[model samples]
Target chain A: MNHQKREDLVKSVLFVFSITASLILLLIIIFLFNEAIRLFQEVSFLDFLFGTKWNPEQGLYGAFPFVFFSIMATLGALIIAIPLGVSCAVFLAEIAPGWARDATRPVIELLAGIPSIIYGLFGLVIIVRFIKVSLELATGETILAGSIILAAMILPIIISISQDSIESVPKSFKLGSLAMGATNWQTLRKIILPTALPGIFAGIILGVGRAMGETMAVVLVLGNSENMPEVVKQLLGKEGSSTVMQLINQVPEILFKPGEALTSAILLEMGPAQVGGLHYSALFALGVILFCITFVLSVASNYILSRSQISVR
Target chain B: MINSKTSDKVMKGVFWFSALLIISILFLILGYVFVEGIRVVNLSFISDMPKNNWREGGIYPAIVGTFYLVAVALLFAVPLGVLTAIYLVEFRKEDNLTSIIRISVDSLNAVPSIVFGLFGLSLFFYYLKDFTGGPTIFSGGLTLGFMILPTVIRTAEVALRTVPLSEKLGSYALGATKLQTISRIVIPSSIPGIITGVILGFGRAAGETAPIIFMVALNPTMPEFPYLFSQCNALTTQIYYLTSEAISIERAFGMAFVLISIILISNYSARLINKYLARNIRR
Candidate 1:
């Protein structure tokens, strides 16, 4: 009886620690939104979401171009990463010999373990220099530089998740396809990819979440601007003397401007901006937006995971 | 059938190409860091201090700082995390409170580390200032402790859940109490998994630059014994500073090399422990 009572007490204390941890997450969301909602009162939601100018110094609090840049950089990274990541997963899950899989698995794991700061440094030295010479540009920190580093950083996550899904396809399914006269490659391409589509899609969404939340590394290479990319504007045939056109030209003369994305904007503003200022609140507002987007994406992926018949989770 | 054969060949080529690309990217990153970093990372460089406004000398201080930071983080986090796991696994009643806690933990796991930085800045700097003081090693460690809580709890829970029910039943059958069964059997069995989480979490905390950026201050005066309230420099943040400023490219590379080695060794050790654990379980 005495021992049982002591056990219950110790267990209750442990329970409190665990509950406190979860409570902190709820507190973070409420606090971030609490700070962020201040910005909404200062600037209408439409202007904050769609207005083009982001000269917070001039009290122009538009953040749409930063949003556009973040999306473009993330999409650019995905364009490079998806093919490489998905293919690598397919190879590891279905094609690689056991020895080969063991050898390569550690290498990819090591790649993932390499810190983001190191990647930023590598991009700054070799990639930035390479891009400058190859593209004939004055400076190399651009959307492209950020995208390359991000793609590398996100590749491991994509490969690991995608591979899990591919391997989880029941052995009977593979044998069935082969017995029906399909080749190994045909079975993988026709049956396996389709079956694992939801998992792969989840992996991609998670990768996007990673790329979007990334700050320190992207900040190092992307010049941290609030303007649109010239390459994008040029491709759009955007040449005129209108306000938007002038804004595009105002961006430094380069194929890709040294630009800031949304996260970088927050990082840059967080340090120097005075506490409790509108600028400070706006940065927090940016954090709130990011938190919401990632939260939704994560919850959506969880839904997909639950909905799927296969237990990728 | 002929068309299908041709498509198979094409798809096979694509898969092989992707595997090749991943290997090459790995080699490129490793090779570049090693070649560039090896030139500056001599014994003296590792053992010395930053001299001449950080243009010369070694990175001894940053190494020490990272050790204390990681140690303090583990010291605070490991106990809380392990306790939480024990509660969830051993004492959970499956009621609404328990389910809500589980969901919140899952959602917490999904929150990005940078958001933790923001909250850390606000909580430690703005709100919890009375206890945390301001921008100290303790505050940074606390912030990181929060950041890594989900990792520790989830891994510990997994390790606990893996313990067989028969072992507990056997202990009870022998007249040992529930506490004795847990302390003797369940915990001993779970130690390896908990250690794995600690090491991985340590590696992550050591490498993390975002979470502590605002919560920790720069100690320009050099590394004396770190106090809870004193500032310190870490390997990752120092690399970021050194690279951006280009103050000393060689030192930045050297630091990068060391930081990479720290994480690599941690990962390799985790793999070894996991293998050893797996073999023991089979027996």
Candidate 2:
């Protein structure tokens, strides 16, 4: 073949290959929804989403407990990870010596590379035991346990991305702040952080998405009990105490109790649920819900990242 | 000025402590696992099969199974990922199609691993059950392949982007077609980046447990050699089962040690390869 024709042929082949990622994504959505919609036929969409009970054996499939716990765990993780991760990023970006920075990078990378299963095992053996003994709970596998593991799991992602963004802030900004009688901390707090806020926000969103979708570590430490926290039930119940102080006092009890997450719900039940059955379809619906949540988060992250890049440039 | 100075010092101390705490977590995990697991990880453990219903013995089958799964995942992912990346970097312009493709790739990366498992179970295990023989290594590997595809494409694209424009222009000036320029100038210069991407993908596939759990069964006995269409075991799944069952804590730690070692070594080697390649390209 002529060179032009050969080039055309190669281009078309690569084009087909290029579209495969999009194609696979399309297929995944279609397949998940196709199976998930079947569950709606058996159970109303609102009932599936908002109903509280999730006993599959008797045909009750309320997913609210799982959704509530997943959100709580993710929020808990964010609270723990954000402050520590941002401070660590600042240290690496502006304060750490070159050798220290170099040494820390590989450690973080190795930490990130450790599998979720290992994290789960570590949590199961160590964190759960520690929490059990310290908190004097019947079981240590609670929302707090899951959140701690998730915070650790997502810390690397937050630190690396936040560090990059912080480092990318224009050197001129820092110099100008310092020249105007600003202390190093003052400049970092006012100038550098605001400049890198979009990127850091994007990283935190990505971490939230990860923590929400995390399965193995969460499943191992969450105890996989499909029940709403007792505090939430009390608050919503008619005769429960309405005092703010009392509610505040119950927060620790809520966190210490065992719960379920969306990802763990699917993982633990996938095996016993017969294929094409309502149980299986309900799980796929959960998958659909997870897909939508992460999809939005991912799109938002990409949008912020792109916007930040343009602004920086 | 005195008050501000004291506050700054306190803040600096906080940052240092945060950094130190993060690093200490890594060391703590490593130290805990190695101390408990190292005693159980002798040559016999590496080579021998699990005996007495996985309560005692080495994880040879799981080790072999992880290798096969990673190998198959790489086979499916590398070519498609690299080629797709080539098209994105070389052929595509800034347009709606490009943006859509980029969004899809990012979205795919963000999709939960368990969701991928569900998709795999639906498509490969049920729809194509006859072809895949239902929950075999083939299905599991393909599931992992899709799971890691975005990582491969994104990394390869960055690598391809790093090849200087001048080198491609010189190839074109020498009467090379686009295909020839890419093959001769672009790919050769960006090989290290592509290799790095592949290595990263391999580590990811090997370490993933959720995507493979439903598609592959835990084979207590050794799988038939080279049986791609049969149920198989993997290190990640084995660790999951062992720990969850609380059968043998020692064996679980040993397997976790093995899995972590593989991932860390691969990540370290990829970094080294990229460093070497970057220096060479500059020269």
Give each model's whole-structure lDDT.
Answer: 0.80, 0.90
**Superposition TM-score, candidate 2 onto the true structure:** 0.97
- What is the alpha-carbon lDDT of model 2 when measured against the actual structure? 0.90
Supply the TM-score of chain A against the true chain A for every candidate structure: 0.88, 0.96
lDDT of 1 by residue, A49-102 (tens): 776777878888877777777776788789899999999999899888898788
- CA displacement after TM-score superposition, residue A17 of candidate 2 (Å): 0.5
Q: For candidate 1, lDDT tens digit of each residue in B142-238?
A: 8788777878888898989998999889989999988899898889888888988898888878888887878654433344554766777788778
Off by over 4 Å in 2: A235-248, B276-283
* lDDT for A7 (candidate 1): 88
For residues B1-283, could you state the per-residue lDDT of candidate 2 as single tens digits?
Answer: 5698999999999998998898899999888888888988988888888898677878888988898888889999999999999999998888998899999999999999999999999999999998999888889999999999999999999999988889889888988889888987899889999999999999999999999988766756455745888777899999988888788888999988888878878888998998898789666
State the fraction of real interface contacts model 2 keeps: 0.87
